[model samples]
Target: MAFIQIIEGRTSRFDEMQALTEEFRERSEGASTVRRGIETRDRDDPNRFMVLVFFDSYESAMENSNRPETDEFSQKMMELVDGPPTFHNLDVLKDETS
Candidate 1:
């Protein structure tokens, strides 16, 4: 089944966050594991950001999450944020059909 991961955080360092976004884009570009991704900032809360990532399957998502590039990117993400990020892993059942 296709899976989605939602990552939410508040950033104190915008420059570092921008760099991390670039790094994530670079790492995800050629990755066969990632299906799609969208990053957005909360309209009501400027410090809040969310990333929605999709994968072909749970296993593929886990594999990508464990990659060295992902690990390094995660580290940079941590450094750029104010608090620990909240992650939600979900199985996407229906979308367009719904």
Candidate 2:
């Protein structure tokens, strides 16, 4: 099943975060298990942000999480945020395209 991880947080350092994300993408390259990702900002709150990351399976996500570079990236992300980020892990039950 496809796995999605939703991460939500408030950050005043979005530009820095964006740069870090780009760096992570370059570093991970083919090693990353992420199939897709969507970055969004809350309409009502400029500082609030959310990221939805997709993986082929829960195991793939777990594998990415276990990577040392992933850990480093996560720690850096925490530093840029106002507080601890909220995470939601979901297993896709249905997916359809027209």
Each prediction's whole-model lDDT (CA): 0.86, 0.96
Using Cα atoms with residue i matched to residue i, what is each candidate's TM-score against the true structure? Answer: 0.89, 0.97
1-98 in candidate 2: lDDT tens per residue?
A: 99999999999998999899999999999999999989988999989999999999999999999999999999999999999999999999999999
On TM-score, the candidate that comes out on top is 2
Model 2, poorest ten-residue lDDT window?
37-46
- Stretches > 4 Å off in candidate 2: none
lDDT of 2 at 8: 94
For candidate 1, write residues 1-98 as lDDT tens digits: 99999999898676678777786787678864788888888888989988899999999999998888888888878877999999999998987853
Score residue 54 of candidate 1 by CA lDDT: 95
| lDDT accuracy of residue 24 in candidate 1 | 78
Assess candidate 2 and give its TM-score to the true structure: 0.97
lDDT of 1 at 57: 90
